[model samples]
Target chain A: QQQVKQSPQSLIVQKGGIPIINCAYENTAFDYFPWYQQFPGKGPALLIAIRPDVSEKKEGRFTISFNKSAKQFSLHIMDSQPGDSATYFCAASRFNAGGTSYGKLTFGQGTILTVHP
Target chain B: EADIYQTPRYLVIGTGKKITLECSQTMGHDKMYWYQQDPGMELHLIHYSYGVNSTEKGDLSSESTVSRIRTEHFPLTLESARPSHTSQYLCASRGGNNEQFFGPGTRLTVL
Candidate 1:
């Protein structure tokens, strides 16, 4: 009954290498897709997000490629550094407007990424 | 960083003990959520609140209970903790733009 599925439970890459993590969802009601990055001892922080309206979003060295029709998305880190080593999660939620409904998220199985210096 | 905070970053208690995990947000947001995650695993929603006095169960079924007595404070209580309940609990708040901000999380271990 998992709604969102992510691949590559763990990954290792050398410094300056690009690492990509992929995810797919089964629910079409999902309107917003977001990626979260978590350090070893900290809470997850929003790295990047995209709406179904767009095909891709780029923030700094992070890029999110989204395919609405396919219900798939992937995260790409360009020229990754050792500091980029962490766990990444992809989440989806249906958008509700007018500030009445709570937008609960459905998260994917996190991917642990390690960048060797 | 979000203004969300969770108290007792790490807790270890005996089984059958009643415990409460505290969560608070200073961002004045109306929506708050609680998520449970395993070590290096995905996050599963346990509960969420839209505003004061409005609480709802999330997609994942959980044995814990949550209360939203105030807009800024949401506390989760486990009446009888068990070893199976050991996991990391994350508290989050949502702003107008629907972006969620997570707290540092509480890692609980029931022995």
Candidate 2:
């Protein structure tokens, strides 16, 4: 069913620029959205997350802008660095599904981002 | 550091061999999960557990079986390995809201 879908299978950006990645989901029951960053040969780590209640949330140079009605969210990385080159995954989950909402993540395929210096 | 470990990081075996991938977490979390991913593909959940002695199948139907005999340990076993079963398996744990911590993963190749 691919409840969540992400765009731009790959992205290329320069240092000190903003690289944006977008995602959209079909399941309205989903209440939480999280972004994960994965490097080569490593595990995916939580980058930032947002609840539907907020229009936007920012952590340092990373920001998540969410639009509930549109069922969409995007990640913005400011002053992107070469070290930031990696794969990004957007995931969604429902808090009340099957019992404890202990993070059964439905993920997007993934986006490969490249930051050139 | 919060430790979530997966052992046998890489394994290549002939078909029909029985194999088990081990996962353990030191953070004392009650929830655990197993996901399978192909190269450059989305992660698909294959199994999960809420606590010791509890387990459930996930969205993707898998030939793997799992057990939670202890709170920190969750091991996935394949009765008979096949070429179709080759994939990278990831283990994760979370306490709430699906904010999971993932292990490096076990990449298995079945010939």
Q: Using lDDT as the measure, which candidate wins? A: 1
Report the CAPRI category for model 2: medium
- Stretches off by above 4 angstroms in model 2 are A96-102
Highest DockQ model number: 1
Q: Residue by residue across B1-111, what tens digits does model 2's lDDT show?
A: 669999999999999999999999999999999999987677999999999999999989999999999999999999999999999999999965557899999999999
TM-score of predicted model 1?
0.96
Provide the overall lDDT of each model, using Cα atoms, as 2-decimal numbers. 0.92, 0.91
- Alpha-carbon error at A114 in model 2, in Å? 0.9
TM-score of chain B of each: 0.98, 0.97
lDDT of candidate 2 at residue A83, scale 0 to 100: 96
- Residue B83 in candidate 1, Cα distance off native in Å: 0.8
Displacement of the residue B5 alpha carbon in candidate 1, Å: 0.8
